[model samples]
Target chain A: MKNKFIYLNNEEKISSNQNKPFVYLDNGATTKVDEETANIIKNNIVEEYGNPSSIYEFGLNSFHNIENVRNLIKKKINAEKEDNLIFNSGATESNNFAIFGMAELGLKNNKKKLITTKIEHGSIKAPSKQLQKKGFEIVYLNVDSEGFIDFDQLEKELDENVFLVSIIHANHEVGTIQNIEKIGKLCRKKNVFFHIDAAQSFTKVEIDVKKQNIDLLSLNSHKIHGPKGIGALYVRKGIDLKKIIFGGPQENNLRSGTENIPGIIGFGKATEIGFDKNEEKVKEMKELRDYFIEKVLEIPNSHLNGSKDDKRLCNNINITFDFIEGEALLMYLNMKGIYISTGSACSSRSLEPSDILISMGRSYEQAHGSVRFTLSKYTTKEELEYTFTCLKESVENLRKLSPLTPK
Target chain B: MTLEYTKKVIEHFTNPKNVGEIDNPSGHAIEGSPACGDMVNIDIKVDDKGIIEDVKFKSYGCASNIATASVATELAKGKTIEQAKNINWKDVEKELEGLPQVKVHCSVLAVNTLKKAIENYEETIGIKKEAKSIEEKAYDELKNVVNPNTGNMLVDDKLIKEVSIKEKKIILKIDLSDEDLYKNNINDEIKEHLEHLFDVIEIIFIK
Candidate 1:
């Protein structure tokens, strides 16, 4: 059921169920594009096909439309007028630009240290390692058993040599929402640049760059019902980041490739529409997520990862079942047509367990058994019930067949 | 669309053949770890001519573990002890078409358990190695038989009160209620299985 494209005229509406019936719970991995966003992308491809770089009437119109979309995104995030949004392929590129680019800028200023947490996404973690190999000291702040960042450790690591402190606003795997406002204020006080990877939290949570005092923020479209391959990195007026890719002066010479016009327009439309229903969407997500968790925990020897008392992304639920492997569980769920993810989608293929869980002091057994269920605005109660039934049956069968008895 | 596993692998995995164990098995071995999500146990009954009369396996893992073990038992059954010992994991992988690169260890688990069971068989009748006392052999075999419902061995369940072997006859005193879910056919299955393992005239299962 992958890579199946449908061509629809303006009169014909796009439906998600056209291809097949599936209970998709991997919204944290990526969300399904809404009808409005799909229509915008289609119209952009069919009617507004002009290259914005060219000097013509259509090109000028394209350029104007792009600016309008950018403005719409700017308004959605409630950023200051001085802030600039640099579009990129997605959060990975934005994170690279934030981490690697800042590391280079830090090196120029004789600040050879970068600060981050062990629970940051691989996009940030990998770039941090790259910087580490280049002789820059990368300090990974520890998280408690509940996946909460140690503010004391952050305070101890902050020094004049520390140029950038990059943290994720909402972790992709465990769904723990960090205290970015406090972290931002601390970074501002320490005169260190703060970058927040808001890929999972952008549209789900309220974020104001000025109010949060965040210097650099990474936002992606696909995680918010927008089209894929389009994201934005919000940079404050005073902070200057070196370009990772060299090209023409597009995106203020930071990201210099031809813009993804259709994706950008779809992102704008998705954001605008998503914002219109933000409160209602959050309520629905919380209800579904809570109901699912309550039922899932009723299974014996199942435990939730990360903090339950603190704030988490409304749609994310991560749980670990003792004596069962996450990959096996995922396969069983996949066979049942209930598509969910295990651990981080990026690292699930690897034999290694989730680093995020390991960093939170969970044992390898716990980390290996972790499964993530991320609901979306489109997810319904019927889907949740179906997923629950399939999950229970799969777990019972797997455990019965498993050699590892519960301790 | 089909998954990466072969049709044979999927078939064996989904509806595994000869699952569970042989009571008072002539040869038995447990290998791999459920922590790493791959564990298999093989039990074999050897005939007087040193040929594998019957083989069964129980595995706790993904499709690869279950399929590899199922196919391994099929390859070893009815083969001579020497021939079964020579059946390597690569042969099992080949018989199942193939396993994923990461799941190659599952084939290894199947082959190791099969060989270990053959080794245990050889030691039981003083064929190729030193033989343990009959009581020790019976204890080891019974200790390895895991309960499919609870995943614990019978010894861990504290169900067996007495185990005695006289000549070629083995008697087991299992403490359980008739209303137990595993009660129906419990005595008949154990009697049939142990009779093959010891080459005995009969087995008495006393409750």
Candidate 2:
């Protein structure tokens, strides 16, 4: 089959004013909505425009499409009949709903303690803190230098008062994949609800929610080459998750709104295609990512962040070049039409260093000098080669002009 | 969001002028912290009469630092030390068209280093005077000039500090707030304004 992904070469160098192919290496922030996904969205808007909540044939068609999408996701994750998916705006909203919903439920049961890691996404972090303000005790598990939460530390923190254990399946910045299965089992043995923010790892990592004993899972479509505005949270049937959004009863009153029909259809199509080609794409993306990592680290004074082995995601490569700023490197690469990001996209605009890296025990300077290059299935070997060339030159040039003295 | 740097900023950043260090320089100064991701080191060669013969800088920062420092050296070269010392960060920002709101600190870094270089030159030479000379008096008057961006007198805000003075060269230091903006051409403007009172040979600033 012909490659449907966008490809750019040196001859087609794109500038800000031009429409040309450019190297895209920041997939962790967001991926290009694949052609199939875009088409589904277009068809849904033009041909199947209906509010899923209305009691009519068109509305029923939209409602059926949403159910099909939910079932597809549930099947992909191996969720059992006990688990049901409810749609929300995206992973942030899904995560907030899961955390705050579970926290509220836990409060009624006299289980006022919440457990999570320092490496979780901001969406999870923010609501957990808000729970603290409402007199719920919050315990943050610290990740090791390689970005893995210590199971022993987690086991020690788990008790009857701890109502839920929320952890990121894969870190968005460093791409470290936590052993969610083991974490889930531990939480199950402790009789605590387990919530996984699998936004970055949903399809990439095969998650059997039933076998893993996951009480809740947060996922979004955008990171999986789907539409941007749709995501879902899987709540285990027995878990009492209090409603966070209230209005006309929708999603069985778990969430209430006119469902985003086009976004939902696009998400379903993307997931179907993503899972069908998962094996080949994983292999291709892994080889490219590893090769890029091996080659990029050859640049002097550059070193990788997170795991050196399989625990890291196949698509992620975060590295720090000593003596130069990451923002300067990002700017230089951006000027060359090689798009990458420094730190987390959520905090990139702020002058502060990556708090995630700081939590992993890196010094402020190391955190400040770090950049992330995330690959997608669309990334080809040739693109990786070109990116390396640009990166090496940019790093050398910025280092030459750097005032940070080499130690 | 991507910061929209001015075209001049892109130019100076891509092919920065006077981008190396000077050996056995008459004056030298460093400002900002690399740990915090903005820093600049300026070296200046001044004549015995206090004229700035040459200036060079090495910066560690985003595009703004390189651009602002490039413009700073271009503005200070061949000007009297007093005039160079009187240069403000606002003028550097103006010369580069304008810097983004966040990058205005780059201009402050450049201007502060230039003044510090002048101060280093004055300290190295035993050009101390028993009384305020004509050039020193002129510097005193020009020293109170307003920061173009803030519109406040430098003296009243205590943003500008007098470092030291020798026979013909004077050094001043500007302590920029974390939020100060940058502009260009304040050096030449100050020199023309003060030429009536002093035959100033050199000036430097430190921050």
Candidate 3:
């Protein structure tokens, strides 16, 4: 189960010496698209230029290419029925489509509430707020410091007025996995539509649509090392959603646009390759995440931001260092050709701290002081060691300049 | 996305100048606030000639914050007290070539902290200065604090709806409870500006 993605050895790397070695640990943001995935995308753009809707041999092949990928994802998730999935722009569109579709059903069924969580992606958070403006009661389920939502709260909120409940499968910031199976069952018991945004957990976490009773699941490429701008939504059968996109009636009238054949096929191949050795990949990343977290917490006044148990994603580590800020640390590491990211308010144009951290009961200061290091399967021990050395020095330097540091 | 900071800004951030405190300095002032995710303490040594001999800063902020402080310290070092007070955020931004537009505010904090440190030094050495009205003092503190929402002063931007000075306490009713990223920094800067004179400060944000 060794990874098919190979890293260049020391001898091979010697030719690219002199320049600082690049070590990127922001896989949670977006990964370096897989080599084979990129090649397929390039080939499709050059060779498979047939329109999916055209009635020709090339177009038929193009249409089949799109379906093949869709079927591949369907089988991966153990979806209940065929023709319930439709290709979309990406995770954002898929999520938006799911929410809007459910909103339509809710309005007709006399349901007045939509239940979601504070830790959802901005797509879900924004739309839920918009629904509130549109007279739908929006309930944001509360999560603990480790990001597990209170089931009691979910149960209490799942009244008959609730039509849809959407949650993230795995958090983008903390990488904490939710109990989707349990949530899906609870939603089923209440006759509510259960939706999950699984962009971060598609191949990384196991998802079973039928067994879990997930009615609407949002998925995408890019985060799984595939080409960007192509994603899909799985709408369970028996759920009648009115079509919102009014165009040339593509995607069985679910989505109406010319298909991105290259991205579709590229995503298909990437997800297929990602499944290869994924269990082993997860094991390696989990071990590395644990070891790295343990080593980092050795620094004075450093804290691990989330739990490090089985519920944590295999590749995520978020930490807050006392007396120093995360953006400064991010830049310091960036100076050494090592790139990581911070969830701090200073990290973005909007000066507010990370919502996920705040939702988990973190103080504004703690959220500002936090940095996230997300590893990929291709991350090497040597690269991590080098990162640790730089990180130690950077922390020491920043702390020395911090008045909060004890003399 | 990063701010596309100039090489000078990166260099200054990587190796900050005059870091930490100066032992028994003639003047010291801490700007920004920890609860707000940024605080800067500037310490300076002024000789009998009223020239700053040494300047240092302790910063808990982002890269631009540190870099701005470093460049401000570099600009303040060896300058006369009056000349140092004249140093502005624009001077710091110019010294670093340019900062990202949004990050230009950090330079404002740096320059203000330096000026406040110089003012403390002037007060310590028996330099008589006129005591301005509390309203004027509030205006002085918030002069450079801009709101990106309006590209104007925070007060002018309606971020702070009301400001009242009651006894020894200054109360500010700000309406940025929606987690305006700048809320903490603005709160800290106001406290930094007026906390020297006012013992009790309570900032309440209205919905």
Candidate 4:
């Protein structure tokens, strides 16, 4: 199923299913490229193969097309004309550049402290740790049991020495959406740079960079049904970021890399479909997510992980079942053709529970029992019903085999 | 395409065999814990002449844990007590066609739990190690019971608040929270360990 070259032609799109139902519930991991976006990518590959930097009509056309997608993304994010988007390999590089690029300026300005929450993705967390080696004080704000970062802690941590307050907009594991507007206003008031790792929430939620006062926003493509290896960092035309990745002065002397023409076009097309306010698709996702949660919680001793209200992402359903390991539940679901993910340590090489759940005050057992089913725009009621049925059977059967279950 | 696990692993994990508890079991054993992310509890019913009648298992682990225990229980169901103890991790792996290297520990846990269940039964019917004093007997019997807290011997932890043996009776006071997640595990461990060493085990939990 990990066919990287499946996009080479249309015939390869049909996987050998033997007619078994293939319910994809791991969209938080990555979404399948929609037909429109895939077609765009294929056409861009075959027709527009010129490098954007070449000095000819073909190259000029490619360069203009890249700029057109950039303009489209700017409109989608609703940034001012002064704001700029720098394309990169994905959110990982964008998050790195947003952090390390600012750290260089912060070092000269005596802003040695950086602020972030414990639940930020690894791109943020790992770089924060690296900065610590360079004598940068990184403060991790705490979160409540529902995965809400303490706003008061953020306010207290904001000081002249703090350079960046990078937080994940929607948590990848539990789907808890932070109050980004409030966070932006606080950072803007303090004149501190506020960055958001919006890889998981960029298209799922409505984001206005100017209204939110976001300084740097990390956006990715594959999570929103676009091709992978392409993302953008929206710089609000103010923060002077030192070039961490130095090269031939491409990306307007900001980020130096050859333009990924096809990737940029796919990102633009996917964002057009995602950020165009497709309320019907979003409503279906919300309804199906709620219905799946309700049906799954009908099983005894099952608890939802994140907020049950509008604060949570519409397509994310994370639940913890008592007396069962999340990895086992995932296996059972996989057997039933329900592809999902888990927070259990046994399935990981490090053997540590998810930091997002642990920071939310879930014990090791509770964290290990967590399962996340992230629906996509294509997810349907029938798929959810089948998932629910398989989920109930797995939990019941696995709980019977769990030593933690009372005899 | 097949997953890293073999077909038998997928089969056993999907619909495991003999995955439950045996009420009024002749011997019972629990291994590992939830904090470690994998735990196995095996119960056995043995007939006369040391022949295993029925065996069942419950797991708080992953696919490998459940499948390994399922296969181990199936292998131990009708075997004699000695043969059941000989059912090692390698045999479980071979039966499952092969477990991933990371999941090899799961097979070991299942086999250890099964062997411990048989050993507990061995002690119950006066077929285990010789004992001198009540404390020594209790310690020797419980020496193999892994601590649910630290994955060490249960005797290593300060759970025994007080212990006194009057004739054949062993009065033991243990300090454990009433709401301890592993309370039942400790109880099962105590009974499995002390049942052969003493005619009576008077357990009093200190709140």
Candidate 5:
């Protein structure tokens, strides 16, 4: 059967004769929006163009659509009680709001310490560092070689001074899923606010805020086959987060800006689809992941970077070759049309090796030679075969020039 | 010739030449920079005319680095000191087809090793000259100077193999057996009392 996602690429072709199959394995960066979600975004912008803030009949209809999407997302995540869901540009802005806003609110009380992991994405790490420069003491919990945090150290570090604990639910590099439930419980006991950067993990992994004892969560729509430039921050009921941007009191006074109505609606619909299809998708992805992992191991000196167990995200398979540069491998594979990521796409330009791998006790050399292959439900066996073929040749070509390799 | 090397540097890297080391050699020098893993040691046998008749090298580093070393050795063999010293990195890269921007440093390592080997040879020559001058001076000064009790000059009593001079101090390398010395008055006798005898100063024990 032809892949629906590949078929979407055909529809993307401007002319009928220009269609070509492009296997996209970089879904961890961002996914191609599904047809339904894309249609919803197009219709909302082109036809339903009423300003949500306006009180006229047409404006009221648009406002209702916005509320409907908000409520739909609220129900999808099982956010009990009337929790405030504020829409933002993306997870970066949402993360900024959660950390900086919370820090701002807690400043008067002298609760200034922020606890987070060493392997968090730049969106979380950047704002946390900014907070640190502004007099907030930041404690970074170290992750093990498998990219899981040391809970013993975390328990010791959590104390009265910590105002917040912000961590990514799943690592973007190695796909190690953090134990958010235990972390959430620990935060609750310490009375410290816990914020999850669920950009990569939100729709892929199941999350229940109340069950996990989560206080705040940041999510991005583009990561889950929805429109870009739209994301939400789930602020638990009774939590007081100060506004960072000022102008108008929209999003229940939590976020003050003109709401991105169409993007939010698309985000909500995408979340709904994800929640419904996550089970089947996870099963299919696990099968494809196992196949890819098994085949990749046949290559000499090839090893998986993350956990082999179910604790890892089913879609992610980060591999390290003994004597190859990640950039060279990525470029060679790209020439073959097998798209993949060397690390987080945002930080790929730095070429400084994976911070997540370094945190996991991988040597700088190992981290530099790492490549991340994240799969989606749309990925097929044929794509994996083609990727494997290209990868074998690329690694061989790169290793031929490496001085570290033995004859 | 143009100063810039040709693109052949990359080709040499892709197809490296003369990879391993030779068995035995007359002179050998190993140099490494801990900052980077660039290491090269060359062993050579030069003819009376100062031509490098035979050269062998072992390099542990990047491809460009190793290739540069191999190419540098090949280029240095038939050339005189003047020509070898004038050898530029561009020539090494020209020997190889081309090199990527990052791997250009490998070629630099090769060039640096070539310069180091020449410096090592010159340093060896200086050491030899200094040693010969020091021996001549010591032989003239200590010819008749004797141990007070044994009535023998310290140099006449033993064979010296090596001598090193630093600042105002002289260190003599000698091979001696304990049975060659008589126990009685060994410390207070000849060598001990010679301190007051002449300008030939400080004797040391060696094995």
Candidate 6:
């Protein structure tokens, strides 16, 4: 059967006879929404235009749609309870709430320590810094060169005064999936709060809140091919989280704002579709990823940043090319109609080395020279072949100009 | 045809001249900003006639910095104490082809180090009178000048530690640790301030 999963732009198909558009390799930055999910969003915007907060029948209809979507996500992730899911702007906001809310809770209980790792995204690091300034003792757990957190060090750092352990499910830069289930079990045994920023791995991996013992989980819709500007935080029942933003009573008086009904519906649909397609997609992506890795290894001085065999996300591949700047290589690839991200998209312009890689014991130079390639369900073997060709050419061209490379 | 820099200047950058230290030279001058990571040290030898016969520099920075040091040495070689004082950054930049706009200050570090070497050379020759004259000249011009960025007088701004005029080029060596001067727009401010005083100005930040 013809693969219906191949990505094609409707606008391009209608306007031109081009066989292929740009090969987008920057799925880690943001994936294009599936056609079905896109249709749901489009239909909501076009027809269901009423605000969910309004008192009219149309508003009621939108409100019911919001609840249905929430329920769907609740069922998909198997959250402890339906009310535990609280919607926010995106994963950044959800992360902020998780960190700040936990800190505030700790403050109320006279606990002043927060435990986290050095490799977390800036969304976690920035808030952790804020908490440190606010008089909370912050302990940053270190990671090894392969981006694996030292669980022994974590155990030593955990104490009675420690408030929360916030970590990313899988690193966005190097694609190292942390043992959240093991970490969660430890946290539960210690009676400590655990929060996972699952933005990169939420839909890609199976996450059972109870199985993992996750107290709080943050997820972004955009990462799963849902609408942007919509995400949710799962705050376990009986956990008292202090509200960061105070306004009109909504979201059980936790997050107060006019609900984004259409985006929420799209997020819900994406979540449902993601869980359904995950098993088959995972098998396919792993095959493609392994093949891509095999081809990439042929290039000299190119190295994988994370573990080759483990519980890594099937779609993520982070490789570092010695003697070449990642940003320059990315720009060259973009000119050739291949899109990929170098390090965190949020901090790409800052020229700062990846914190995740640094914590993993990589030098600043190695961290700066790394590029991430994240695939989606729609990614095909043909695209992978084209990507390898473009990458080989780009690396050679970049090395020619690099001062560090010898002739 | 690209640019005709002195062969010595390009040679020093490619295979630098007088690399490392001199096992306790008569005098040592170390200068550069940590923010910029540009540093230079110069050592000199003087003969009985109070003429500078030898000059060597150990520089840590970009390509322009090494070229500047090599050119400064060529300009200072065999020059009497009186003649070396007139060497300026413009002369160095001109001698070493032309530095990129962002790296013009590399030339300044070379000029600054040469001035420090001269000071040490004069002291070594026991010419106390000439040393005072050189100090007086540097002190006079730098005293009234203000760092344009901070709007504070150069002497009062505390960023500048020493200033010398050599060959119509004024070299101002600054201390980067002086918070009020090197923070934010201060570099641009100081550059603009120095432009109005002399036809060619060079600044060396000594952290």
Which candidate number would show the highest DockQ if scored against the true structure? Answer: 3
Q: List clashing residue pairs in candidate 4.
A: A401-B59, A402-B59
Best by TM-score: 3
Ranking by lDDT: 3, 4, 2, 1, 6, 5
lDDT of 4 by residue, A1-407 (tens): 13421221122134435666789999998999989999989998999888889999998889999999999999888887778799988999999999999999898898899999888888998999999998999999999998999999899889999989899999988989999999999999999999999999987777889889899999999999999999999998977888777887788788887888899999999998987666777777888988889888899999999997678998899999988998888878876678899877463423343868888888778888999999998898999998888889889888877879876
Residue A184 error, candidate 3, Å: 1.1
What local lDDT does model 1 show for residue A365?
Answer: 66
Could you tell which candidate, 2 or 4, scores higher by lDDT? 4
What is the Cα-based lDDT of residue A194 in candidate 1? 94
Model 3 chain A: ten consecutive residues of lowest lDDT: A1-10
- The lowest-lDDT stretch of 10 consecutive residues in candidate 6 chain A is A1-10
lDDT of 6 by residue, A8-53 (tens): 2333355564654578777788888888998988999999988877
Q: How well is candidate 6 docked (DockQ)?
A: 0.04
Per residue, candidate 4 scores C-alpha lDDT tens digits across B1-207 of: 123677688778878898778888999999876866788889999998778999988888988888999999999989988788777777888898876555666776788888888878888878877656668867756544443443333555556778888888888777766676555555665775577677888877676
Displacement of the residue B83 alpha carbon in candidate 4, Å? 3.4
Second chain of candidate 3: TM-score?
Answer: 0.73
**Top-down TM-score ranking:** 3, 2, 4, 1, 5, 6
Instruction: Give the per-residue lDDT digits (tens) of candidate 1, residues A1-407.
Output: 11221221111223344544488899999999999789889999999989899899999888888899888888877777777899899999999999988888888899999999989888998899998888889999999987889999999999999989999999899899999899989999999999999999987877888778889999999999999999999888878898898978888778898889998899899889888878898988888888999999999999988766338889999999887777667777865668877762211123233878988987766777789999999899999998999899988877766657552
For model 5, the docking class works out as incorrect
lDDT of 2 by residue, B47-92 (tens): 9888998999988777677889999999999999889978897798
Model 2, position B153, has a per-residue lDDT of 52
Candidate 6 residue-wise lDDT, B52-111, digit = tens? 767677654444556677678778878887898899777876776555433455675578
TM-scores for every predicted model: 0.81, 0.83, 0.89, 0.83, 0.69, 0.68
Clashes of each: 0, 25, 2, 2, 10, 9
Q: How many backbone clashes can be found in candidate 5?
A: 10
Ranking by DockQ: 3, 4, 2, 1, 6, 5
Between candidates 4 and 6, the one scoring higher on DockQ is 4
For candidate 2, give the docking quality class from DockQ: incorrect
lDDT by residue (tens digit), candidate 3, A129-226: 88888888999999999998888999999999998999999988888999999999999999889999998888888989988989999988888898
Give the poorly placed runs of model 2, Cα more than 4 Å off: A1-21, A344-353, A405-407, B127-207
